[model samples]
Target: MDERFEIFLVATPGLEAPLAAEAAALGWQPVVGPGGVTITGGWADVWRANLWLRGATRVLVRVGSFRALHLAQLDKRARKFPWATVLRRDVPVRVETTCKASRIYHAGAATQRIERAIAEELGAPLAPDAALVVKVRIEDDLVTISLDTTGESLHKRGHKEAVAKAPMRETMAAMFLREMGFDGSQPVLDPMCGSGTFVIEAAEIAAGLAPGRSRSFGFQQLASFDAAAWETMRTAAAPRPAPAQFFGSDRDAGAIRMSLANAERAGVAGLTRFDCRAIGDLQRPDGPPGIVIVNPPYGARIGNKGPLFGLHAAMGAVFRERLQGWRMGIVTSEGGLAKATGLPLESGPVVAHGGLKVRLWQTGMV
Candidate 1:
């Protein structure tokens, strides 16, 4: 169970840099790549990665790899794999395959071969909807097999049940916070706080709460899982006080309601505040000015940027007049809309979100 292997932390495409930085800060030797970060460790490290990483979409363990130029070779190699050491015979498993510049170019055929090998050789039941997934990649005649150790996506967080339209995922929100130089000491405010993602994420970080504290992961279903050891690791994360307050507001009363509910479910309601008001009514909180981040409507889906541009300009004016000392981060798809903020902003990475590409613009000080 302590066999060292490659652990891949899947990032949200453009957010790979921040995710790698986070892994490095956690004392892991993170190697940055295109879609994720790579670290090497054993099963305990796998559990810890699932329990600690807020920016990761999922965690995968590369258990084995070999050269298989054809379907028969792939089948023979997969049958010879030590699946019993990594996968349970009783737990249902799903196999997904992909081919890139490889001799085994048919993904469906590869999937069938792997599934047959696991089912007949290892006697593990195969199901399409299984929680435990075995991922296969045939790239350049090399067959790489990995296990999806983090199930149900880390963004679920096992807390918030309700979500608003185009709501930002918790993982993305967290990485975005890291990009803005947040260190849990300064307050965070989100005016268009749909479902209170940013504010609640900030509060959790400030309070030293593990993002995966309330959730279950796919690693628990693997054969290598040790229940007692996992319990110790999961329960080791202790919470601390959030030094500064977090604030969220929205013009829609229902949005504010959702925000309040989400904050409460996330156990950060006491440290966070949600108000129903227009952006114009936003006033800087009494304490020290901290950071203001907003995910305004991109208007790309609506096919209209006229009103959105005006809204951005108005929001910018309100920030200039009201929240004078705070820094700002604005996320939107339209360059026109972000520029309309009229703040001295520098552009960050372009991230893929819900089929649309969005960029984060950061300002030094309002």
Candidate 2:
């Protein structure tokens, strides 16, 4: 219960650098770690991060850690630990535990012990499906406790209820946009946009909108939460007019409708446009050159990979013929698919998306 606690910003693997960069840009000096970036901050910092950071999948506040040789010691320390400072008695909590290289190797037993300690001392109800979660990790006999301040993964965004098959997570889309050096100053286009994730995200970023503005956070239920202060923080950023338009096109009319609905719910419909068109029929918008980002169907998700070559080639032909001076970011699992584009693409880091390892293939002004 220190004034400033360690906050871990979890990122999708292979996307740590961009997330770290974002944290630094937000005035936090984060130390990059295995699965996330760690920074020292208080409860208010946690709230702000959950509200502002688009790349973070979840925010975990490291409450405390202690050396526990056995479950008895763990239970005693957990009972004494200042749970009142973080966990509210009125809210329910779920305790999850992991034991590694320790005598207390039974994760279930350790979870029960911590659960008993919290219920007995803090008077908080324990439930199997509670929004608040206490994560305990016992590694090398060191018990580290953390709280998941992001209830339903940050990707939910509380707006994009309509999703297409093989839809991209908002968190990953944000990071991918960042990777393309999208500062929201220029236009963005998704030729094969499914559910319009990239286009909607770009429009929102251009409007200077907070990703979590439409959502509620788990931190609001914590004991240290200050309602007035949180309200001030969440509404601090005034939405601005986008510099340019964002566009999305899909062959499926259903996908186009879903994109429009999703954009409306995200409050970025004014800055975005969606159409039903095949890649070959896509025409560049009337504006200066911008970035073209698309998450096209891959072999794993959609139909056979054999015929995709022609589709990719057609996409490349359209981009080369119509989208000159426009940069490109293509997310696909197969290198042949990207190569078939014939756009002189250079591969970036490989990312894990929906159980398939995909890479961002980038091309300088096509």
Candidate 3:
């Protein structure tokens, strides 16, 4: 395989900007485009992106591409491509196909051709439930092949076994924290901290911990993987102490228990605390003020709107009274419900989370 190829960092719709910013800040000149931020590098870049990028859903290496205007041409090209350079003959892989503005538009037929090419020619077994996936995109009559270098979604994080209803994903929470101007130098508190995702993400950022430290990635199974070099890169940086503590609170005792357990599993229990308390009972901790980010129950997700307005209004009052001088971010499905909080909040772009369209409402200080 060539030492250089394209690495695509997949982002959810409307979130490609922040992910690009993060990639650029991490020293890669990222090209912002639809589907993701793309960069050109080698296998090490693939490994590093999976380890360092918290906002990407999965990192894909665009290995090769070709032009095929018909099904027979695609079958011929697929059989001749150099899959053995990156894919192992022993590892099993699954094939998925998508066609856009292409003459050869039978996606199922295309999938079959590639599957047979790899299975029969490359000597790799094809399985329906394989961990590795070879994604084929036929766009503008050009066949683009990419390997899913990230097996599971990056949000898994290999920790946080417990999850609450309508839970915020770790990837979204991390990007939201960055959007709220969090730099890991101040405290972070989540009032409705379900499963402690926001708090754990904040604490991890503060401690300079890599998001993929506790997990293995699909890139490790690729033929080009360099174990010694990856190990050296992974262990070169040690985690440092957080500048300030992180806190989470919830009305449900079970939620608090879940938060504590999740934090412990994430190795941030020493820098975080979970309390079983209502929003009304929340008081500022004795430290420098920071960001207050919360993902409260959305009316659409819960099938109840009557109580939510009141809940938001009450929560707004609590923030006004107790959380002054702290910047606030609230994630909710309805703008009306978020405005009911009555903070000086401006709306961010709509993000798709847990099958619901949600936005992040932010304020200067509260």
Candidate 4:
């Protein structure tokens, strides 16, 4: 058994640093790579990462790699590779291949070759929509094989059933929170909290709940998975009490209801509060200074960008006047809208969100 393998923590492109920071905080020596973070660990580490990592979109295990300049050589190597060690004979797998600057440039042909190899050698059924995925990359004639340990994106934490329009993904929200310097001790507030993503995530982090606790991972279907070990690891961490309460307020009553329901399902209802109120009605809660993070409407998905200037200006005015000593993190698509707030916000990196590029604008204590 290969105890040590290369682990890839797939992160959203612009947020790789926060994901790497998260991996490092979890005691993994993370090498910042393009599009993700890389670590070297065993099957146990793979399991733990799928269970504990909040910022990673998916966890991929690099099983092995070899140089194959031609499709025939790739097929031979693929058939001889130790597939039984990682894949189960009973579970079906889907093979996805990509080729860049390589002699075997036809990805479809390469995928078919690998699929035939797996079926003949390992006797595993190949399905188009299989839960398990075998990812192959042929770049510069270097073939690398990896397994997607996460069936669904980690953003689907299995608790948030109801979502508002243009909702921020939980994975992106986690990275944004990390970028905001949230340490899980102070309170968090999302004024335009659609479905309570940021508040609930913060509450969960403060409560020491694993993001993957409510979900099942693709690694559970692998041959190397130990049910008893996984159960032990999942139940090892006891939930902690949050030091402060998290808050979410939205003008839509339906959104508030959804937020409340989602929070209850996530086991953070006691630590979070959701209210139905507009941005102008947002009042400072009774608590010590904390971070206020909001993913407001950016006009691309919600409405016209014209009237949003007044809305941003109103929010900026309220935060600047009332929320003294509270730090603010605003995620928006337009830099002008972020500037309309009239707050001294230093722009962060532009990240991809729902096909549109967005940036996190942060301000010091207001």
Candidate number that wins on TM-score, 2 or 4:
4
TM-score of 3: 0.98
Candidate 2 colliding pairs: none
**TM-scores, one per candidate:** 0.98, 0.98, 0.98, 0.98
lDDT of 4 by residue, 164-184 (tens): 988999999999999999989
Candidate with maximal lDDT: 4
Off by over 4 Å in 4: none
* Root-mean-square deviation of Cα positions for candidate 2 versus the true structure, in angstroms: 1.2
Model 1: worst 10 consecutive residues (lDDT sum): 297-306
Candidate 3 local accuracy as lDDT? 0.91
- Model 4 — which ten-residue stretch has the worst lDDT? 295-304
For model 3, residues 1-366, the per-residue Cα lDDT tens digits are 348999999997667889998999899999989868998898888998999999999999999999999999999999999999989998999999999999988999999999999988889998999999999999999999999999999999998799998888999999999999988898999999989999999999989889998899998889998889999988988999775579999999999999999998998999998899999899787788889999988788878688999999999998888888999999988999989998999999988886788899999976
Q: Which stretches of candidate 3 lie over 4 Å from their true place?
A: none
Q: Which ten residues in a row have the lowest lDDT in candidate 3?
A: 236-245
